[model samples]
Target: MTPGLINGHLHVSQHLLRGFVPLAVSDTSAYLFKWVFPYYETLTSREEGVAATLAGCDLLTKGVTMVADGGTVRHPGVVADALATTGIRAHLGGWSWDHASAPPGLSMDTTEALDRLSGAMDEVAGRHPRIAPLATTIGLGMSSDALLEGAKSLADRHGTFLDFHHSFDAGEVESHRSSFGDDVTPVEHLERLGILSDNVRLVHQIVSTAAELDAIQRTGASVVRCTGTRAARDLAELRGRGIPVGVGTDTVNVSNTSDVLRALHVFAAEIREPDSDIPSSGLSADDLFDMCTVGGARTLGVASFAGSLEPGKSADLVMFDALRPEWIPMIDPVNQLVLSADGGSVESVWIEGELVVDRGRVIGVDELALCQEAEEAAAGVLMRMGARARIGRRSLC
Candidate 1:
């Protein structure tokens, strides 16, 4: 059995948007404001719960036993309830913003935003005791300096982890430079705010400067590098700096897959030039595998509870069927696991000593029926948001 994989960054509510939205990698603002934000606004609490359930089921079947959710602002309780039912260990954060204006149709001022976040911290503790509270800064560019500081303060007080989006795309980098100044990058801004800490987990530090990278290393803060966004050189540099780097699939709308093995494969292969010497990358299959497991656990601040198979640790592990075609002639277990094997090789999964997936299927839920519901929910949401007309393709079939 392999140690259960952990997805260090995920958006549980955005699972329904998979394949529904066209990704415009160049125009981050249009993608968020036009498609993503509006679609989120259309979801009812029930729909959100259904989406979260679908996501959890997908991850479980893919041998992911734990996740750190980037919670939606509308109905985080719904997401918590779904995750609880699915039996996946998770740390959840609430929707938070203060500096920038709320997206269209959403009403939020700084006072209301802080108040909502404070209430969410208490709500998650009272309602979902298993789920830890994570200080959230929607994104560095979107969150004000006050909000960032407040989030860190909240995390410190609760002794929990802080999660937030950082420099993932060009638009965000431009925004950060414009908002703060030309000299100070987003990482420097975070350092100046005094929010960078060991408890902080910054997502997608793709465009960070040397000073910012220095700050991250000095503060002992971890980073979740999504395979879909960052290059191999960037990852090698982060690893060389002795930073605890974890792998994440990001959102369904972004990477479009919840498979950890696929992400692991990308992380391993993307770091080096095809013709270049492999030794130059300074990463091995073992290192990437550790990132998926123990490294991810560390980023989520649950290393003691999960990540590895050891005495006193939670009974979370995955059994890959070695007889499968993908596992045939597996001379190196780590290489096979990282470079070739995928969710299809997963025969069983156990989380907290309980079997959640068996025979390559999630046990408790009728996955097909749940996917059917997700489809209906997605269609309804798109229709309500009037985004169906904007869909690039006329027919999905």
Candidate 2:
């Protein structure tokens, strides 16, 4: 038994984008301007609601007790309501960017953007005890200076973390660099804006440099590495610096599944580019397990109350079926969990003493009906999107 997994970063509004990406999608820029933005602009409230419920159901069944959203582009209130029904704890925030690079109908004026996120915070409040609202941004490259500063202030006022995407892929790295003339790194830019404090959960650290990693460690900001679109690179280096780190599934479009255990299995397979400063032998199964549970809770800033199987902490537990092949003999629990077992072995899950998942199926919702609604919702959005998405896609690229 363990504290349920925490997806330290998630894109709640992009759930329905799964399985619909046009074949042969390119890097981040094309992905953002062509597909993700268009889908966000066209998604209806009902579609977002169904997607949120679907995401929550999948997460709970996969032993995810807490999820911190990257940001939502549409009706965040509807998404909140749907997750509330699934009984999963979450950290949510709205998305708005003022950069000219932001697609049409997505960007807002500086003040309007800040106000919109603040309003989203208000809307999420009192919705559920487990659902918290925080400050968020699309990405550093797509956010203006004022927006970053404003988000920091908002997070300070709320005493919460500001979840934002930073260096992930090469395209995003170059784009953020083009806006600055100085030789300073990305983390340095945040330092100049007074944004790289303890109240930040920086997502997608694939492109971070040694200097940037130093800055992150110095500032006490946590890192949430997404294993969906990229391999788990330099995770040991992050831990070597004593930086709090967690793992996430990122977006459904790229990930296709929110199962963190399976995500880690893929992560273990794709591990490469180890730093020389770290151990010659890379991460172990136990280390991966820690990242999914307690380390994730710390990254999401809920460690004081949850994340471990302790007496004073919240009651969140995952019970696996020992009779399953994955748990057979149980010679090494951590090894079996991180390397062999999938989420299917999860027999039940308890979040805050509430039985949300029972006997390998989520409770309080018809599994058949949910899948049917998801299919209908996805179909509805795909029809409106026209050639932007199709059913015969081979790769999201």
Candidate 3:
């Protein structure tokens, strides 16, 4: 049994939007402003619940027992309710953005944004004690300085983690430099504001420089990198510097899958590219596996409670079927796990000493019915958002 894999970052609300957004490889702005924001604006609380349930069910079945949800600006209670039903451990919260250009009905001033986040935390903590609060800011470019400070302060006060996107694209870095009017990079800017810390977890960071990497290492801040972004060298460099690095399946519309094993496979292959100056012996299959298990747990600040098979730790682990064809020639266990196996080989999963999946099937949920529900929900949401017309169809379903 391996430690139950932790998804370092995910957006459950976007699960239904998989394949609905036609994204170009380099177009981050279109992925966010054109499709994601519009889709988010059209979601009701009920639909959010459906989406969350579908996401949680899929992740749990794939051996992800815990996730750190990058929240939407609406209906976090519905997210928590869905997590409760799926019996998945998660940190949940609402979006906190103080920018004037935020989507309609989603934008708030600094004070209002902070208040909304704090109130959501209190509400979720009181309503469902199991779901932890995740203090969030939209990002360095979109969030005001005051909002960033407030979000970090809130996380510190509540003893939780602060999550945000940072330096995910070169354009974002350029925009931040333009907005802040400083020659310093985005990571330096965050350092100047005292926002970088061990409790803060930044996502993407694909455009980071050496100085920024040093700042991250110095501040002890963690990073969650998505393999779909193809920033393999960045991930390896961070790991080499002894910084905590975790893997993430960004979003359904972005990475197109919640399978942690797939992310791990991509990460392993990318880091081992030929003709690289870095030695081939630098990263082993075991090291990549640790990134998904212990590294992810540490990045999420849940290492003491999960991550390993210790006496006092939670009994969270996955059992892969050794009898599968993928494991028939398993010469090196770690190598096979990292290079050959996918989520399909996951035979069973346990979280907090309770069996959530057995024999490759979720214990109680009716998956077939859930698929029907998800299809209906997806159709309804797309139609309501007027996104149906945007979908490019080449063949009849």
Candidate 4:
């Protein structure tokens, strides 16, 4: 058994839109502005609550006891209360953005953005041990330099970490170059703004460079790899350099599942570089396991309690059934876990010594009811969005 896994970065609010992003959203920009942000602009409190609960249920059955929200969740109190019903720990990043890319309804000026973020953080503080507010702007691509600095200041004032998506794809990197500077990479631009620090966290940091790696190393920032194999190679380098690394399955809209085991499958098998003889990550299954557990806890700033089963730590553990066919020769537990297992094998899950999941089902949550509610919620929310009429136009189907 191991400590319950931590999904280092995710958008719980995006769960309603899972499997709905059109096939034509070929890049991060489109994924955000076209699909993601439009949904965010129109999401309702009821939808947010249901989505967070469903997201918590998905993570709990998959052996995740805690998660870090990727921001853009417009309703933290609603989402937090819903997640609390499932006994999951969370750090929420309420949305903050002041950029032209944002829909007018969702946009805010720098001062307005900072005020809203600060209010959200304060609004959730001391309310629950497991639920928290993370100072977050969606990313540099949607936030101006002034908003970035202001968000960092909120994190500092609140004595918590700041997080955002950064350098996710080629288009995003180019946008940074045009907005920040042509000469410096996006990471350098953040460094130039004094935004990189030990307390700062980043997600979707796919673009890598020697200087970027150097900056991340020097600033003591943490990175959570949220998507595909491109970041897999850099993850090995990040870990080798003693930089903390964590794993996430991204949004179901993008990856279709929040299962870390699925993320592991992508990491271990597809981590090797194409058209190259040498393996990109040279990491063993055991290393990968650590990244999922303790390393992830550390990256999310919860290692003091939630990451491991050590003495004085929080009681969070996942037990896999050994009688399954895949475990016939379970000589190596880690290998069995990494290679042959999925959420189906998870027999039970506990958080704070309380039984939360048993027989691969989440207690106190009705899968059928929640799913139906989500279906209704998604339909209602999307139906009101002006972007709804523009949807089927993009899908190849």
Q: lDDT (CA) for every model shown?
A: 0.79, 0.81, 0.82, 0.81
Candidate 4 structure quality by residue, lDDT tens digits, 1-397: 8789888888888888888777556677667777777787788888899999999998999888888887745787888888899988888867888876567778777788888888889877777888877898877767888888988988888778898887777777887788665678888999999999987887878777889999999999988887563656576788888888888877998768888877877776666447643356568888888777998888867789877789999889999888899888779888878877876788899999999998988899988788878777777777876535334322111
Q: How many backbone clashes are present in model 3?
A: 0
Which wins on TM-score, candidate 1 or candidate 3? 3
All candidates in order of lDDT, best leading: 3, 2, 4, 1
| TM-score, one value per model | 0.92, 0.93, 0.93, 0.92
Clashing pairs in 1: 232-271
How accurate locally is residue 276 in candidate 3, as Cα lDDT from 0 to 100?
Answer: 53
Any runs in candidate 2 off by more than 4 Å, and if so which? 22-24, 228-230, 272-282, 388-397
**Candidate 3, 1-397: lDDT as tens digits:** 7889888888998887877666565476667677878888888887788888888888887889888888856888888988778888888787788888877757688999999988877767756645888898778867899999998998998888899988877777898888777588999999999999999998888788899999999999998887655556565677788899888887987778888888888877766777554344567787777777889989888889877778889899889888888887879887888888888888899888889988877776777777777777777778877767454333322
Per-residue lDDT, model 2, residue 23, is 52
For each candidate in turn, give its C-alpha RMSD to the true structure in angstroms.
Answer: 3.0, 3.6, 2.8, 3.8
Once model 1 is optimally superposed onto the true structure by TM-score, how far is the C-alpha of residue 78 displaced, in angstroms?
A: 1.3
